[model samples]
Target: MKISIFAGVLLISAALIFLGPDTADATSFDTRHVNMGMKADQCTAVMNEGIRRLNQANTFCKSTNTFLTGDNAYHTGTICRSGERGKVWPQNHNLRISLDIYPLVECNLKNKGAKYPDCDYTGVAYTNRTIIVSCTSDKGGGVPFHIEGNLVKYK
Candidate 1:
């Protein structure tokens, strides 16, 4: 039971840690999000929580008027698992987050490990808002905005 709880935190923390300010300009784009340890079973829950966190972040961004287009793309079916998985100890809500240009990461305390509860992370995220780049330019429809970035790790 104890180990499962601890692992749960680890999974969620990995994603929440990486939420930095948006750095997308004409030159280069800069985005960030958390990355889970591939070896751990916590990857599942981390992915789930990532989505939740992303939604929360998007809401905050909207309220703040950070992005005109608003947040796009979401973590789908992320199940950041705890080390304790299966019937024994499965996470409730896995950590699944989304990466957006209007960045504002609200790191969870779990990422701080057992030491720093006020800890946070900032990972480099990449996304393309325009779905139709070449096609849009050719058809004179302009580029359609899109949002695609790191997906929550599963299995």
Candidate 2:
């Protein structure tokens, strides 16, 4: 009986460990794709950051849909294949940054290059969470690209 109970406990613990964090994050969630919170200038800067980050890694990437829970971070994804087309990839958690105090009207970008709408997008969550996603072709410099919005919830 003791051994059985210990084994069952271990199984349950393992399940819980895997399920718990996902559930918590899923429950604490919000998302959207075509948000219009950030202005032209703000969007431009966010795109620049995405480009710089991707250049170093030279890989496709996405921003976390969740915004403004902390200093936040973004993640880099693979080369984004045809299969991952039109998917919202959570590159980071909150990547969760939030001004959380004001209307977030200024785009809050401090030191970024000039604004250009060549290719790229930026948006703000209702809670002032910001996300940027964009890309370009290596040769043509005119390859059409689209950003995927990953919206997932824990079960």
Candidate 3:
């Protein structure tokens, strides 16, 4: 009886370990793509386009949809790992990583708004100085994917 109970507990633990929630999802990979070897300005332009689309869909900006929590006005960095979490990708000459600073805004609806979806423009607005992206080889060129966030440094 003791051996059977131990085996059952071990099996349950292994199942939980393999079935835990994953941090990255399909939507996370659905980010804007940037070509490898592109200049900083070009990469920023692509990211800006994604932000513009998100802003347009935001109801606080007078759109018909509401912004979900944790949504930023600009493209912020995402947790990037080569394989499972914490495993780093082997360095290669073709891999390109770029870091740049960009503007980030947070919008909220005013509590005293006369009507719904009234723009408040009272959320945090600051510069994201640590936008890190990685570009890997694709069909014709490298496509940027992984976005890593870093601690904000004030200067």
Better of 1 and 3 by TM-score: 3
For every candidate in turn, the CA RMSD to the true structure comes to 21.7, 14.7, 14.1
Q: For model 3, how does the per-residue alpha-carbon lDDT over 5-73 read when each residue is reduced to its tens digit?
A: 999999999887764432232234334322233332232233334446666433323211111122332
- lDDT of all the models against the reference? 0.26, 0.34, 0.36
Better of 1 and 3 by lDDT: 3
Alpha-carbon deviation at 98 in model 1, angstroms: 23
Residue 123 deviation, candidate 3, in Å?
4.3
lDDT by residue (tens digit), candidate 2, 1-155: 99999999999999997665434433322221222444434554555465574463343333332232222221222122222321222473212211112122222233333332233445444333233223232221211122223222322
Error of 2 at 70 (Å): 28
Instruction: Give the candidates in order of lDDT, highest first.
Output: 3, 2, 1
